[model samples]
Target: MDYKLIDNTEGKQYEYHIDGVIAKIEYIRAKDKIYLTHTEVPKELEGQGVASALVKDVLNDIEKKELTLIPMCPFVASYIKRHPDWKKLVLKGINIA
Candidate 1:
C-alpha cells in the first residue's frame, strides 16, 4: 500500500492517514534520543499494514536525521527485531526487549 508519513513536530508524533483513520507513532525527544513511546492504529486500519508502514517511515526519518531511538513501544521493538537493519537506530545502552 502507498503511504505518506508526516512528522508533526508540534504534536510530537508521526502520523499517516488511511481509509479515513489516522495511525500514529508518538514520541518524546530528549537530548539526542527520541523515545518511541506508543503506536496506535485505528481498528479499521488494522491488518492493512498501516502500523508497519508508519513505523518504517518513522525509522527512516530518524535515520535521515542521524538521531538515536529508544523504541519503548512493543510494536516498534518487534519491528526492529524483525528488521535488524533498523536496530542500528536504537540508542546506545538502551534495551527494549
Candidate 2:
C-alpha cells in the first residue's frame, strides 16, 4: 500500500492517504507547541497500523523541528500514554485531561 502524508492548510489538518483514499486525518498546528487534535483512521484502515505510522511521522517532524507536542487527540494521547519513550517529546505541564 502506497501511503503518503500531506498537510492541507485550508483544512488545517494532515491527511494520510493510502493509495488514493484518505485513510486517516489529523488536525495539527505549529506555534509555541505542536498540537495534534481529532485524529481518525477509516474503519477499513483500522488495525492495519496506519494510524501509528501517521502519528510517528508527525512526532518525527516535531522532533526534527525541536518542537514540543500537545497531544489533544485521544488516539495520540493514548499512544503517548502507552509509549513511555515518547514522553520526552510532550510539552511540559500540558495537562492531558
Candidate 3:
C-alpha cells in the first residue's frame, strides 16, 4: 500500500491523510538530527498498519534528507527494533531500546 507522506514543517510533524483522518508523527529537528517524539493514529485507523506505514515513510524521508533520527517515541523505537535495517538512520550515540 502506497501512501503520500506530508512534511508539515510549520506543524513540526509528518502526516498521512487517509479516510478523512490524519495519522501523524510529531518531530523536533535540531541541527543534523530529528527527534521523533510521538505517533498518533486515529481510533478508526488502528490495527490497519497505518502507524507502521507512516513511520516507515517518515524514516525514508529522513534518510533522503540525510538526517539522523532519535526515536523518542516508543512506537517508532519498536518499529526500528522490528526493522533493523532502518536502524542505520538512527543517531550513533542514541539507543532506541
Candidate 4:
C-alpha cells in the first residue's frame, strides 16, 4: 500500500490523490507543535487505507521536522490510540480532543 504523498505547502495540507479523490490532513502550526485540525477522505477512497497513509506520512514528516503533534481531529486521535508508538509524538500536558 504505497502512496505518493504530497506536501502541498501552498494549500497548507498534505494530500494524497487516489481514485480521482483527494485525501488530506489539514494542520496549523503553533510554535513547536502542529495542531491536526482535520482529516478528510473522499467517500470513494474510504476503506482503502488512504486516510491512514495520509496521517502516517504527515506524522512522520512532523517528527522529522522536530515538531510535536496536538491532535484535535478525532481520526488522528483514534489513529494515535490504535498506534501507541506514535503517542510519543503527542505533546505532554496538553489536552488532546
- Highest TM-score: give the candidate number: 3
Off by over 4 Å in 3: none
RMSD of 4: 1.5
lDDT (tens digit, per residue) of candidate 4 on 1-97: 8888888878878888777778899888888888898999988778988888888898898889999899989999999888888888999976444
- Give residue 18's lDDT in candidate 4 (0 to 100): 79
- Model 3 RMSD in Å is 0.8
Candidate 2, overall lDDT? 0.76
Q: What digit string (tens of lDDT, one per residue) describes model 1 on residues 1-97? A: 7788989999999999777778999999987889999999998887988899889999999999888999899999999989988879997776657
- Give the per-residue lDDT of model 2 (tens digit) for 8-58: 778877778775567444556667577787788778777988888888777
TM-score result, candidate 4: 0.90
User: What's the TM-score of each model vs. the native?
Assistant: 0.93, 0.80, 0.96, 0.90
- In terms of TM-score, which candidate is stronger, 1 or 4? 1
Worst 10 residues of 2 by lDDT: 19-28
Question: What TM-score does structure 1 among the candidates reach?
Answer: 0.93
Whole-model lDDT values for every prediction: 0.89, 0.76, 0.95, 0.87
Q: Could you give me the TM-score of model 2 versus the true structure?
A: 0.80
Candidate 1 or 4, higher lDDT? Answer: 1
